[model samples]
Target: MDQQIIMKIDDLRMYFNTNGGVFGNKRKIVHAVDDVSLSIMEGETIGIVGESGCGKTTFGRAILRLYKPTGGSIEFMGQNITDMPERKLRQLRSKMVYVFQDPYESLDPRKTVGSTVGEPLIINHLVRNKKEYEKRIAELFEIVNLDPSMANRYPHEFSGGQRQRVAIARSLASDPKLIVFDEAVSALDVSLQARIVNLLADIKERLKITYIFISHDLSVVKHISDRIAVFYLGRVVELSEADELYKNPLHPYTKALLTAVPIPDPFLEDKRDVIFMDGEIPSPINPPKGCPFHPRCPFATDICRTDAPQLVDMGHQHLVACYASQEGRLPK
Candidate 1:
């Protein structure tokens, strides 16, 4: 189903300037997205999975220009958008929108649902008359399975699931081609998370939209992703199809992540090795030189300590950065 590249982020870098001293004197950088590169197809969902603080959210934000990138190029539909002027970027805002993690904090409590959803249309001046605006808002609400009549109500009146639905409706108001779901359902109840994930999938087909889904939940990524990229610290350690990644995770960090995902079976639970990783995540201000994951990896060796492994393809769309074999028989 690949027609053309919809979004391409090349060597994206975003570092936050953090003060680390008395009276906020010493300013250090937190290397969030470190020279990351990826291409997103027009309508495929690309899931980004990583531990918190590993830069998944930062990467997503960098893509949408929420955070101005320090370096690298972002191309949308083959147009270089890295340095697109703010006015131009603002004009193109409807094409790419971000659905934030905390629905409660993300949505303005003071604004009514109708006004919030219709804000985009008003800003873009997409409506000719008042009737058209109300009709569009009603349609968006209906699409997300929200009560169209509740447009007059505030966000606090709804549950977590419904709040997210309202946010989704707002994001869809402008008919965006790509939407960045930054832990979009993480704060919802377990039962509601599935509904949102499934709704995202269903709406993608219906609307012909592309998604860059950032989540720590591997299982949710497994559900919605066409391709999955596993991030360790600030670098991509493994990337592959959904099933291939889960079945044969090459990176030690990826393997550890998968092992930690609780399987819903009492019998098979004890059979698997839950890699309880030791040590806190190294400070992003001064990450290790070699592989960022090498310090905590059980398979770390001299080579891993000194020379970082590149992302080498192990065939069939699977790529990994680990040089050692788990079973100790194969060559690096």
Candidate 2:
């Protein structure tokens, strides 16, 4: 199969202006996402992982145009949509949808599960009559492994897992080509999370849908993602195949994140050295001068503090943005 690039994000940035300092005299800029670029391949799941405020969610919203980017271009299916009109963007909504973290909040409490799932179909004019709408809703329920008979029940009637299934069903209602799962399973129990992750993988295989799975849990993202991007303070520090990244992380932040994931073997777990970051994550309003991670990086040098490094491709398209990694000083 010929590889296809479904979405391309170039130099994407999202910033929010707010009152400056305690006096609130001047305006300050919150750098949510800064100069990040990546391409999503058709039928592949790309995971974005970082701490709570590392801009993973903002990056996803920017790609979907939910948050209009502050700078740079976004190309979806070869069409530049960064500056596209809202009227035109609405037409593309049917082809792309977002599955939020909390299903309870996303699904309507007042509406029946069937109605909730069918809303997108109605909005996109996917069905002609009431019968067609109900039929499509039933099929969608079954697609996500939910019983069609439960369509009439309210969202409160279902379990957490089931509600997420409904949310997935609703997203699938539009027959979207790309679905952004923004911390989609972080709210569910571990077992439920596994079930949803497997369902997402199965759906991708069956429907050939591309996904942008965002989560702070490295383990969760590792299970569902083909490639993973590690974010640090609104910037992508490293990006590579999931397996390769876990086994051989080049960036200091990436290595630290992997070490934090508990190992199954007691011996390996005890033997592994965990890297602890010293200070808290810098404020986005006034980040550090050079590399964002320089303050906490163990190998930070004068160059690292004075000059930021761009994401450099090492080999096999594995990229990292760190002076140590580029200088071959990273531990083997």
Model number with the top TM-score = 2
Look at candidate 2 and tell me the lDDT of residue 175. Answer: 93
lDDT of 1 by residue, 1-332 (tens): 87689998888888899867888778989999887888889998999999999999989988898889999899996778899988889988999999999999988999998899999999999898999999999999999998899999998998889999999999999999999999999999889999999999989999999998999999998999999999877778888888899887888788889988999998899887667677988878898878788789777787878877777888898888777743342222
* Candidate 2 collision pairs: none
Off by over 4 Å in 2: 19-24
Tens-digit lDDT string for candidate 2 (128-152): 9999998999899889999999998
TM-scores across all candidates?
A: 0.95, 0.97
Cα lDDT, model 1, residue 308: 71
Q: Model 1, residue 223: displacement in angstroms?
A: 0.9
What Cα-based lDDT does every candidate model obtain?
Answer: 0.88, 0.92
Angstrom error at residue 208, model 2? 0.2
